[model samples]
Target: MAPLMRNRSPNNVPNELNVEYYRQRASAGLIISEATAITEQGQGYSNVPGIYTDEAVEGWQNVTRAVHEAGGKIFCQLQHVGRISHKSLQPFGDPPVAPSAIQAKAKSFVVYSDGTSDFIETSLPRHLKPFEISGIIEDYRRAAARTLEAGFDGVEIHAANGYLIDQFLRSSSNQRTDLYGGPLENRARFMFDIVGCISREIGPGRTAIRLSPVAPSNDVHDERPQALYNYIASQLSAYDLAYVHIVEGATGGDRTYQQGPEPFDYAEMRETYYRTDGSGAWMVNNGYDRPLAIEALEKERADLICFGRPFIANPDLVRRLRINAPLNALDQRTLFGGDAKGYTDYPVLGG
Candidate 1:
């Protein structure tokens, strides 16, 4: 599994709590925690962690402490789901808001009162105004502040995977005609603003951003991804933040639409952020292995690698890599929005 960081899970776990899980895999140069909702309104799935609560701050503090004790650095990934959420997942049963009123074609995975599973299609999003947009930025800033309070090394703004930020980044999903949409710069303005706010809250050195330029998951489509992302990279460089994480393959779902006579070259897309200013670090995720990770690092394509499923089954992933041990296969059945069955039940190597 490449980009080893999995999506968010419930903050509370058994013996393998957030602290233990992170400490176990502390050998990784950087451990990006699962997607953390910026606010209750930002949450798309039930039981996922939130950075906005006092209890969550304490829980993540334990996680950061454990990773630090094991000599590892950790980054908190901030996620905000806009139209991709159901009323059940929203705050006070409020409808999820987005840049436009468009409803995402995707369904959100949620748990019922009976503990059964179901998928609910997204409802019409409340088209946000300029003032509401400012509130969203504040939400991100507050989450960043809480992350700092939790003792994380840094924060990664989740602007990919068809979430709230991705909705604004993609032209097809974002039909706004205001300064917050339309052109690439305007489309990217919200992200940049968020970066600025978070930087102010936690400092630029401890800030990072994740972007999926070519991956069209969540019905996100842009006429010119290369141009749009190039512009984004160029703009992001001015901030001199921590790093930029890019998801290279088809994120969220299978690839169905054909680009052209040739498939999108991930290497070329990698160059956009890697060469933007040469100041910030670059991380490449999605379907990467040991050899490819080392190659990307050696070729300077990516400074750090993220592994998702591999870490799920092998907590001692760094040690396994050092000893060339085989990794346990991930159980897809228990992947998303589940309990301890696959969350932390995987035994450590030789344990």
Candidate 2:
């Protein structure tokens, strides 16, 4: 299962609702939890779960235990929103930190005390200093350690979706003239640093990463995406990662979105990783249905296929796909912050 954010974890801690939610979907081959904040400062959306504090770790323990009891393997997706955040969600209302001071032309989810929540313009951000960059990398390392302590089988780094690591990877978001910017290698430094740290913390065999090479989600852009991602793929070959998940096309939109002069090459990137000795499962996501998924696997286009929205309303999605059963429609209203009305209440094939 792909990581889909449902802002139901009030106070950024998982609860019984989350435990039941994952337990229902335990039939999946592997379940990647929603993008979880590594620290309070890494958060951008309200009511999302975190992995840093003792309380948050304990909350996740219940979740992992339930999933495991049901025979499911789950991974925690560690994330930091960086500039894709509002001051209201930052520590002490400070400006969000990023590779550069520029603000993203995006909105963040925020909930109010009156139980109201809405999307708000992301606040301006200050560029991260050298020391602060190291600190953030350290945060990822600690989060990976906590993930295991919380009973998770593995950790998936949320380096895509215009978050902290994505901000550094794209040229449009990073304009610094320091060691961490300018050249493609320099822009990619931050991502590699985090990958190295997390791999060391929780062994590369349990370390995975998600990337949207050309997706323009969260207003991030690049002059040459093909070159950038191919380079990233080649570098990732050095690590013995568990898997490499790629979001094909634009995030939740076009499956053919292009970002530069040359069209983004998904196959080329995968081949690059393989050619460079990348020993990881290649997981492909975005806009997949039963037939499409079957075709990809039959053609050996992917090692694993991940379905996001279909799994949201179909906890028995694996069984449904096996027998070609119909899927349940998603309740758009309860997709974000809400109670059980649209969550675990979704009916199964014979419920």
Candidate 3:
């Protein structure tokens, strides 16, 4: 559900609201938790949760316990918004880090330096040090371990929406002469290394990745997305991940203007992954309603379909879709920071 930015605590601890929220929607077979930061440095927006602290771990454990008790499976999405941040969001007023010092030609949700929380233009970031890069990888490793400890079924590494990993994969964001940048293979090396490390640290079957090949989100773009993702999927085939979730077109935006003018073929990408020995579930997201989801499933376009907006107001979304029931419109005003008015008051069927 988009509009999940409920910055309730400085430490970003999950509370009763979180547990109740997930529990109410437990009917959704696989409930992927919202994107969470791995470390304080990974935080981008205010009030989002993290898995790096004792309070965070304890809080998410409560959420997991609730979901599991309700007979639901959930995965925690680990995300690090690279240059998609501002000084007010970073620790000690440090600039956000990226593969290159280039500022994203995009805006981010941030607490302005003047002390107001709002969506503003992203600030320029400094290049990460070689050692800092390794440190970030270690953070990811620890984050995965923490998620497992908190009793999550698995984790989906966030590599979409112009986040940390996406910046590295797209040449428009990464203009470095080092091994971590330049050619597509080099640009993609960081993701493989992180995925390989996490999979090894936390078992491949329990790890997954979310990617947006041609979305160009967060001011990131590639000259050849088809070749880029073909290589990525083909290379990913070596790992035994649970699945690969792709954001078709863009992440949480206009569905009509999808994949840009030249969209990469999902069929070709799937073929490449399978052809290269990739063995995992394939998931597609973005602009899916019940009818489209059913069609995609029937046509075998995807193994799983993720619905974002629908879940915001429909706790019994799975049942609603199954029976073709009407959905409730989301209250846009209560989307970001709010109490339980629109957050948890949305009625289920017959509620």
Q: Write the per-residue lDDT of candidate 3 for residues 1-351, one digit (tens) a residue.
A: 322355544447888888888888888888888889998878877778899999899999999999999999889999899998877788998999999999988876654345556778888899998888889999999999999999999989998878999999998899989889989999998899899999998999999999988776788988888889999988988888898988887667755444446756888998878634435689999889888999999999998898887898899999899899999998877676556787788999988
Which model scores highest in lDDT?
Answer: 2
Model 1 lDDT at residue 322: 76
Residue 225 deviation, candidate 2, in Å? 0.4
**Candidate 2: tens digits of C-alpha lDDT, residues 1-351:** 999999999999999999999999999999999999999999999999999899999999999999999999999999999998999999999999999999999999999999999999999999999999999999999999999999999999998989999999999999989999999999999999999999999999999999999888999999999889999998999899999999999998898889977778788998888634434689999999999999999998899999999999999999999999999998899999989988899999888
Estimated TM-score per prediction?
0.91, 0.98, 0.94
The TM-score that candidate 2 achieves is 0.98
C-alpha-based local distance difference test score of model 1: 0.77
User: What does candidate 1's lDDT look like per residue over 133-251, in tens digits?
Assistant: 99999999988988888898889899987888889988888899999999888988898899999999999999988888767666677787777777787677678788888787576
By summed lDDT, the worst window of 10 consecutive residues in model 1 runs over 7-16
Over 4 Å off in model 2, which ranges?
275-278
lDDT of 3: 0.84
Candidate 3 Cα misplacement greater than 4 A, ranges? 1-10, 111-116, 256-261, 275-279
Worst 10 residues of 3 by lDDT: 1-10
